[model samples]
Target: MTAPNRPNAPRWLPLGAAPTTQRRVFCFPHAGASAAVYAPWRGIAGDRLAICPVQPPGRAERFREKAFTSVDALVDELVADIGDQFTGDYAFFGHSMGALVAFEVTRKLRAIGAQPPKHLFVSGRAAPQLPDTRKQLRALPTPQLIAELKVLGGMPDAVINEPELLELFVPLFRADLTVNEAYAHRAEDPLPIPLTAFGGHGDPRADDDELKAWGELTADRFALHTYPGGHFYLEKKAGELIDIFAAELAG
Candidate 1:
């Protein structure tokens, strides 16, 4: 596979997946995460659903491109870029900050009168209208920002131990932080698609209560699922996560 040319340009790396069935599930990464995070889901997601992981810039092969600093701009590009993947039935699954981005993308699709998703799976995030617990990290000093990343989970010890590696992540993390901090959720009509909210049972940022509130964002079916672990619980329970997603999309 060819490496990505830029940080902001999406790495449309397919997981060697062939959607043998009807529904296809598109996956989005969390803050500072790349499409490769969902690579583990490819085999188990079943042939019925194509688990295409959306790669945001500034990580993985996209290391050279400038990461998106604004949420609106990122969504705009993604909505336009994902046009080719809209075939057959489709759904969206996003984790942490990606959840909000997926929701916003859904809104943009709706506004443009595009085909809506069959289902929306939002994991590790609060409802759009909920209060933001964490403050913006872009304004923090570099050291402080790294500390915040530690608290968020998912950073490897090797990266922290190596100054060169950590330096590579600083800009990407900052851009992701800026995207999250600057996002403003304007009130809009509820979506017609069903929503399945997933979260870590022990995630400090969002609990079952906060996740359940995501039900209010949609007019269709709503369900909240909890897995064992912290903010990055999906990594620990990847098999179970794929199982849940497959079942939802199959239905």
Candidate 2:
């Protein structure tokens, strides 16, 4: 697996493709995060699930580029880059902001008559149709945005306090917030594939009720699982989460 930080290369980094295997899993990271977030899951997933982490700009190797301010633009770039890799049976797992990206991408792929993922694992996000009261975070002052980040428990305290790091990350945060806030769910037909939503039991962002709303978007099958933690539940329960993922793939 390539480290999240490389000298000067593309931001997205994928890991663990068996030379002979046909299946692959595309993984997307949360807002203000890099592809390295899924590095630890590579060993747990083994060869059955070849993990490909999608890295957005303004982070990791794409740090110098301007971050995408719209979800549509980002997904377009993603499809252009990874469209050919959609030949085999594939699945998608996305967390927080990534979950939003995955859902939008699925819709885009379906519109173009491309192969959709076999399964989609959405973590730490509420269905787009649900009410999102935190939309104002996009307009919050710098200090307030940093404070909100601290409460989300994803960014390290040191990074949040560092002026240089904050300057680098704040724009990305705003871009994510814009993507989330500007998202509008048109009254379209439901997806034809199974949808799985996972979230922390105590996650204020996405509660059980909100997560279950994903069922309305998929006609095939829907499952919602809750773990014990705040926003970043996967951090504490990665082992059990991997087992759940393995079982899902096996089934």
Candidate 3:
């Protein structure tokens, strides 16, 4: 399949992926997360697939740059900045806020006549079109935000305990929450690629029916998998998830 003409992968994109893999999965982290979140997948994914973690600005190596507060702007930049990587056989895996970002990015890619992902794996989030019924926490003050994060099991105690790190992390994550909480879902035809939704049984964000709703946005195929933990369940189930990735992307 022909993709849009763009420069080769930029320096900001890491090259630590499996060299011999036949397919690539660009993994997007949840809100306030960095590319480091997916680092362990490199080893678990083995050689069948390459794990490419997406690093948004204001996180990790790109911490100096400002992060986008609008989903449209982020999607637009992602398509233009990293659209080159989608040229080959590739798919997208995103969790929580990342799931929403990845879904929108795929739509943008298609709108530009770029080669679409082979499959889309969404985790820890509801389908984009669904109305969020949860209380708004994006505008919470520092202490309250920390409380919400702890309640949602978003950050580790180690990171939360470090005052210096919390100072840096809070605003970046709040910006991402702004992107998430303010997202306006425009109606569009379902994408013609297989979609798989995963969630923790105890996840407060998206439950079974909400997770199942991801099928509505995909005309090709749909699947759902429920794990035993909360929003951050994948942290403990990475090895199992990697096995599933191998099975699904064998083509």
lDDT of each: 0.79, 0.79, 0.84
Comparing candidate 1 with candidate 2, which one achieves the higher TM-score?
2
Off by over 4 Å in 2: 1-11, 14-20
TM for candidate 3 is: 0.93
Which ten-residue region of model 3 has the weakest summed lDDT?
Answer: 3-12
Ranking by TM-score: 3, 2, 1
**Residue pairs with backbone overlap in model 3:** none
Candidate 1 residue runs with Cα over 4 Å from true position: 1-10, 14-22
lDDT of 2 by residue, 136-173 (tens): 68889998888877878989788876899888888888
Each prediction's TM-score versus the true structure: 0.90, 0.90, 0.93
lDDT of 3: 0.84
Model 2 TM-score on a 0 to 1 scale: 0.90
Q: Candidate 2 — which pairs collide? A: none
The window of 10 residues in a row where model 2 has the poorest summed lDDT is 1-10
* 1 or 3, greater by TM-score: 3
- Which candidate number would show the highest TM-score if scored against the true structure? 3
> Which pairs of residues clash in candidate 1, taking residues 3 or more apart in a chain or in different chains?
6-65, 7-57, 7-58, 7-65
